[model samples]
Target chain A: MSSSSPLLAELIDALRCLPGVGAKSAQRMAFHLLERERERGLKLAGVLEQAMQRIGNCSRCRNFSEEPVCALCASSSRDRHVLCVVESPTDLAAVEQATGYRGQYFVLLGRLSPLDGLGPRELGLHLLTERLAEGEVEELILATSPTVEGEATSHYLVQLARAGGVKATRLAHGVPLGGELEYVDRGTLAHAFGSRQSVE
Target chain B: MSSSSPLLAELIDALRCLPGVGAKSAQRMAFHLLERERERGLKLAGVLEQAMQRIGNCSRCRNFSEEPVCALCASSSRDRHVLCVVESPTDLAAVEQATGYRGQYFVLLGRLSPLDGLGPRELGLHLLTERLAEGEVEELILATSPTVEGEATSHYLVQLARAGGVKATRLAHGVPLGGELEYVDRGTLAHAFGSRQSVE
Candidate 1:
């Protein structure tokens, strides 16, 4: 849209940097900030600037952090023996929120996607290898997504765990708890059926 | 969600000031920025701060502007004899983009809603009255939405136009273009039927 004000145009254009925000949504956000939420918008700008400049990855787990090490990785209360590996901070957050796994975490920051130039080095596998070789961790839980890349990343991590004499396990792939069998997609249903476990 | 970093938490909280952004979307936006778009995020912060601090209402038309007057109001190419009044700058942009209108514009910035504390004064109708009284405008177009408050605002503007001895016109309201009669809402169909006109 042709905005009469150059600053308004710039604001709208800048808002598009956010995920899922397009031209119309950006315009709406700019107008909203201008019309009603100028104070909060200013606060957002301040916070955004601070986050972009100060927030860094945890030196140990590679999760986002303002300190040298993230709080989760630095906490002494968390278990050090069982390490859950996730692809990104978002997935780590999902696991933290949905499950009761209170062990330590290792954030890969990305899956092993060679086409996207993401490899073991980019994912900070060396740090994970060092952690595993420290002889503290007894188990490595592969909690990456079930996508092809996620599986490959998990498989690679399993080898590293084996080399370090740590037990490696994968998150179960099956139909969701509430999902009906008939409505489940063929791939998930087939995988669930093939991996059917004996009733405990 | 429990963010490991306080700055990350603050960033997510601040992002919710945007229109339509909730907790989940804010978290996603924060992570997306942290993970891949830190440079753009910082750029957005700079632009957002500049926009919030520098942008002000146009002295003549009440549209957003960084200077004393907006580009549209300052343009000599636009006709000064006809003025289109809109509820907001977004509406003004919509009219400017969707139509061939070349006249000047007056942005109310809001409609007449007493419960929401939006009155004629808040809408900048005083400036508009002064503009109409200047005798430069021959026609005052009421382009407000057809909601209860918008209708009331338009009715009040009509009186202002009459008092200023200027002709007043309203946007044609009926079934939307390409809308089938069967699918059109009852109120719109009834209004369209009542205001049926001959093809010119």
Candidate 2:
């Protein structure tokens, strides 16, 4: 708070709004920006602003994208007939980093939690059902987190996918208990991808 | 890294340039920024750019400022005859936070490291000597780090201030060895200020 520059203090406060950054960490980061070249700091600021402005949910897959369709959705190399569903953009990134899945992704903005007022409609389950009914999606992979909410979400999606006549499964084998794919090691992720068993 | 969005990867790389921010931490920060409103991200970016463009060294005391003299140097409440010298603006903030010293500051920009080619002139020791000769400053407080380079710089400054007929002292009595003022608690920092002993 005793920092001489008001702008620097404001910038630090804005950065501290981040999930893990505290006041001290934000101060350190502000000092780092001060120490570096003006161009470097400006570039970082520009990237932050630009990303927030341009990126949104892909119209088809609901994954984050700068355009109407995400790169994965647009890529012909990807298997359109197989869709891997995830809870958030972060989870989608983790799966992509594993580099084992050749299929496209469908990002559910949230999981089904009726207690918290998050119902199937809030998770866009109707849209998913419509997508499944198109008959192009042969297999549906449930790649949500291993939390209680995630389990319920996967079960609901699987039932819906099966009723729509598409094969549906959950990721198993290498994924540990209470695991978040984002924090898992790459080898473990690859192994999990390779050894995934049928949920039914 | 073959990420879905190259811009996201770029932002993460930029975030990693911050002190103590590793790749994973940077990714987390980048994602957090991306999740926020575009206006929030732009506000941070704008502050960063504006701070860099507007803030510069105070002409009198060398601390960060938008005007000719920094707030401390320009204020009538501050002891114009006492100057607290530090390695950077952040260090100056730490001293100010202790609230034991109402004095102006001279930022060295960096410490002396002969191996790194940072000699006396590089740290603006000549300007410090000139300031002392101008005659209002009665005390020169060496508030630099406890590192070898800081000690070497302090020794050099002490000799210069003595020749200029001003009292030169290092805040050694309360400062711990191998510790940075930025990380020191405010209580210890105030104790260090209160118990400062003179250096030869």
Candidate 3:
């Protein structure tokens, strides 16, 4: 759309850099900032600049952090013997919130997708190998998603763990808790049926 | 969500200032920027800051502009005898792009919503009245929306045009072009039935 103000056009264009924002949404955001939220918009700009410049990956876990090592990795209270591996920082956060896993974490940042140029090196598997070779970790928990790429990454990590003499485990895939079996998708239902445990 | 990086947390919080962005969307946007679009994210910050600081209302038309007078208001090619009053700059752009109307414009920035503190003064009707009283404009077109607030604002503008001895006209309202009448809303269908136009 043709904008009367060049700056307004520029603002709308810049807003499209955000995920899920398209032309119409970008225009709405730009107009919203101009009409109602100028102060907060300025604050956002300041914070965005700082985040882009200062936020870096954790040297140990590969999670986003301002420091060399993330808070979760640096914390002495968390267990160091069981390491949970996740696809991204968001997945790491999901695990932290949903489960009572008190083990340390290793963020892959991405799955092992050769088509997208992501492999063991891109996932910082060397750092994970060094950590496992330290002999402090007794088990490596693979918490990647159930998608094909996630499964492939988990399989690769399991091999790495086996090479380091650490026990490898994975998150269970099945019909979710509180969900009706009839309402579950076919793949999930089939998986749950195949993995059913015998009652004692 | 607990973020390892304080800057990342702040960026997520700041991103919520954008229209339609909630916690989850903000987190996704922040991570997307940190993971892939760092350069574009920084550029967006710079442009956002410049837009927030530099953009202001046009002196004549009340549209957003970096200059004291917007390009549309300053142009000599547009017909000075005709003035189209719109609710916002976006509407002005819509009219500019969709039609061959080469008249001048007056942007109200908002409609008449007293509870929301948008009065005639806030809508810049006084400036419009002054422009009308200058005797340069022979016709004033009211292109506000068909909503109650928009109608009220248009009614007020009609009176202002009458007082200035200028002809007043409003946009035709009915079922939209290419829209099925069966699917049209009751109120709009009723209005269209009541105001059926004669064949030329």
Per-model DockQ against the true two-chain complex = 0.82, 0.47, 0.74
TM-score of chain A of 1: 0.95
| Predicted complex 1: CAPRI docking category | high
Q: Rank the candidates by DockQ, best first.
A: 1, 3, 2
Which portions of model 1 show Cα errors greater than 4 Å? Answer: A1-3, B1-3, B114-117
lDDT on C-alpha atoms for all candidate structures: 0.92, 0.79, 0.91
Q: Judged by DockQ relative to the true structure, which candidate is superior, 2 or 3?
A: 3
> What stretches of model 3 exceed 4 Å from their correct place?
A1-3, A178-187, B1-3, B113-118
- Candidate 1: lDDT of A164? 95
Pick the TM-score winner. 1
Write model 1 residue lDDT over B123-199, tens digit each, in one string: 98899989988999999999999898899999999999999999999999999997678999999889989999999
Candidate 3 whole-model C-alpha lDDT, 0 to 1:
0.91
RMSD of model 3, in Å? Answer: 2.1
Clashing pairs in 1: none
Candidate 3 C-alpha lDDT tens digits along B98-196: 899999999999899999999989988889988988899999999999999999999999889999999999999889999998999999999999999
Q: Relative to the unseen true structure, what is the C-alpha lDDT of residue A200 in candidate 3, on a scale of 0 to 100?
A: 100
Model 2 spans > 4 angstroms off: A1-3, A173-200, B1-3, B36-39, B174-200
Candidate 3's error at B45, in angstroms?
0.6
Chain B TM-score list for all models? 0.93, 0.79, 0.92
Candidate 3 lDDT tens digits, A2-73: 436778888898999999999889988988898899999999999999989999989999999989989888
